[model samples]
Target: MNEDTYNEMNQLHESGGAVATVDQLIQTLRDDKNYDRLFDALLLKKRLEMGVPVVRPTSFDNLPEDRRAEFEEHYVNAAREIGSLHLEAGSIPRAWIYLRTIREPEPIVAAINALEISQDVDEELVDIALYQGVAPAKGLEMLLASHGTCNSITVLDQQFMQLEPQVRQECAALLAQTIYRDLTATIKYEVERKQGSAPTEETLRELITGREWLFAEDNYHIDVSHLHAVIRFCRSLDANRDEVRLATELTEYGAQLSPQYRYAGDPPFEDYYTAHHHFFNALTDTDRDAALDYFRDQLAGDAPDSDKQLTAYHLVDLLRRIDRTEDALDIAAKYLLSVEDQLEFSFAELCAETGRYDKLMEVSRAQHDPVGYAAALVEQARTP
Candidate 1:
């Protein structure tokens, strides 16, 4: 609508005819930052060149049979072009709109990852990147940097089940590390203030070891709820990472808290921090057997049937993670097979994983499941 643009467009129309005029119009729209109109104009120009309907159709069924594929090809190409243009214009949300339409997520994911989130981070990017699942790690990074651990922990807890297992583990690991780093700084500062100064040490284990006074009078540092929630979320993380070790230190802190601060949890983890300390220790290959004995001992005591089943599943899962698959298979075959509930651990699947198709067939025949035995028999025969 600017006078100079209008005059130039008229001059193009006079000198170069209709196609050249529309080309200039698309450039004008781009310069004007009228992206929505530019998208429409691109499609319109394509349709005009193809001799298709100038007006958009609601259904493909309305188009001639011969033109459908061509139309679809043009539409896809146009979307990609406009989406790329939007990305180049630094408008991620608009780019996502078109890229998602074409089922092309990688470009948007790349764009999100390429962002420098150290400062001036936008909340909109966080919404799409994390909430929309385009790039969760980056979104979580932004959320943590902009907000802090409280909001990050809340998001992790609320969105935990919806995320894929690996992403959940990554997010949880990140939060655990953040909490550990912050707690270390606070504990170090407190220790220095108390002792008039202290030696610099790396781990929380080192920081809290000699300082029983840190937990005296039922006093503690940091948000206990935040600590508790993060340690709980740490269950999703792989035990090999340094973050998991940091989480173990968090549990160590939990164990040192006053009776009022140390709380109970559901089922097998009713001892809360103590149980998690053992769990992480087991996974990290420190005193694995003792942790195994501790969890198994929980099952020896009396509890509700549901509680017993859940405890059994936890022990079996732990055994499996530790590569004691045979032990896991044994406990699972004895306790989990008849539960009649949909569970993550499958007895047959575990058997197959351990290449014990004979066991699968044996159990199948004992239960009089001909179908199960038949499949297991085939699998056994195929095993070389």
Candidate 2:
């Protein structure tokens, strides 16, 4: 076929709408003596046949070992030839078709070719390779090397979930390395971008809490940096309520990781307890009873003096929550007096709530809290 005719035939085959013209061109090319055009014609035929389901060659598998090996090699070589032609022609979907025909395709080459044409093609080819028992680590490494986009990483994540447990674990281990840093960075950027301007407390909580990408089973080893980044980002918001919400989420996430990964730093149990305590305190009164129960349990345990003191503060807050101001004042006076400086704010609040202006002033003065002392004096002057 001449250049114009060949180009027109190629376009017809690609369009898939002019089946009759493509068939005529295939026949004409088949009759040609030129090997390159003949190869192009064969590629077009295979591309057209792609969606038409054909029974997998059952006999091929049952063939004698040597014959089977030869059979596989023949198909693999043919696919590579056809894929190369389409790849050079910038027809990725057609190229992927030929690549997919090979039982064990070159993931990096196929991914790079497909990505050069379109992200959708790259994603599809990677998924095909992964589901065919190609190791996700290998496929992801190849895909990422091509500078796969956010959508490509997402495709890998979905395919990863479909892998068998051991395979998934192996891939996860592979992805934990620095080689995949580009992919991880893209994923992180996409996630942060999705959070948009003025991400709410709930949004930050969701971002920090989930095991989707950063904390995927294999990813936990590398998760510490991400966790720190998220914590820093949350803090950067400079909103108290959001910071508390993120802290609570991080506390829970850390607790979940503690059993498996030592990378999650060991904050004292009291720190987690206090985080939960404050988180609940920031919520409505509905959580007050649970908060009270939690602190009461902590106090009843063989906790260290520091923990007991912190629990005492929360319990006092909970006591005031349930409208037992007198009980709250008594508890603060009894359990928190020795740690008065540590629990000074809670003690002062309790004193103010219970109309104990004299005690509030005394505690505030001893703690050198001038503001608290002045506030106490005002309350003292107002009381009867």
Candidate 3:
């Protein structure tokens, strides 16, 4: 048997409480089917793993009755294994094959169930199965059982609101986990479907206007993209007034849901900045000032240097934007001497942009060792 078949049988047996030796699994596949069926299953599994959709061949219907029955059994068995081993993140290939290769309805139902049980499976694999139109209602129940948590549901409801009310059915919660994955996967799929363009009004509306999740976790992770999609969806629905309100709510809820993952001060600064950029951008001038004041006040207590640098940059930009060039220079100076070359360059550009050429020249010269500083100043003066 091929590695794909070996892996599938292993996962199936493992999930069913009958762990089989790999050699034993291989021997079983070899004796159980025609070489062509075995070859097709392996090929379909590979296609699914590569994220390529595999349409079922009509040839499956043309197989002899006994062979067709063999294929059906293999497909259902594969689906159950996919679901059972999915909790361990090991059943994606088999699951995809069941969806793409198995045409029999019973096997498709089994595949969908497997996907639901294996809630933590790849978003891409789930997406393939969903697009194939296999047992959606049952599949969703399985998704919720494996993935839905208070946090995950919150994200799901947010995305669901973006859909037509008719399409936004509550995910069933039969198993312990709640699968909000349909909406989450839908968001990712739509983004890919649109090739990174902003979502249309129809798509945007599908994403926003819900009080429940407006934020959700897919699989076992709280993806930042989910937050951003919600933010974008809100803005698209009402960029003028709703932007601020939606942003504020998201900020509040994000903090409440994961204080350690605070929307205001998340580290690796860029992501936090991106997540909350709309809130800051949507603020009235006075509101912006008040918000910055709050953020600046928080920075006084053992804040990371990354946060300080981002705060300093924001302050410098705000000051320069309002013609407080001198203040901007002061803010930039606080971080300029300590940051790396890229930020040093940014500060220098800000100084130039704000007509603080004298300060720019000074900082540039002063940045190096005394000898290098003197050499830089001489070079600057010599530039004319």
**Model 2: how far residue 166 lies from native, Å:** 50
Give the candidate number with the greatest lDDT. Answer: 1
User: For all candidates, what are the clash counts?
Assistant: 0, 0, 17
- Residue runs of model 3 more than 4 Å from their true location after superposition: 1-225, 228-246, 256-283, 304-307, 318-324, 364-384
Residue lDDT tens for model 3, 1-384: 468866877677677633233234434644673333444554344333333344552234434554566655655555444433342344544545543444434554465555435556555444544333354435344444455544444544444434443223222221111112334355445555545665544323344444234334422134544554344333223223434443544444344344445444333233453435533442434356655555455446477777777667656654565566786787677765577474543665565566555676677666655554454455556554
Q: Mind giving the per-residue lDDT tens digits that candidate 2 earns over 43-155? A: 44444444322233312433455455555565567667766766666654566666766643564344443443332335555554454454455555555555543433455
Candidate 3: deviation at residue 188, Å? 22
* Most TM-score-accurate candidate: 1
Runs in model 2 with CA error above 4 Å? 1-218, 221-247, 258-268, 271-286, 314-327, 342-349, 357-382
Tens-place lDDT digits, model 1, residues 285-377: 898899888888887878876777777898888888889998887777777888835566677888888899888888899889999899888
lDDT winner between candidates 2 and 3: 2
Residue 32 of model 3, lDDT score: 71
Assess the local accuracy of residue 133 in candidate 2 as a C-alpha lDDT between 0 and 100: 50
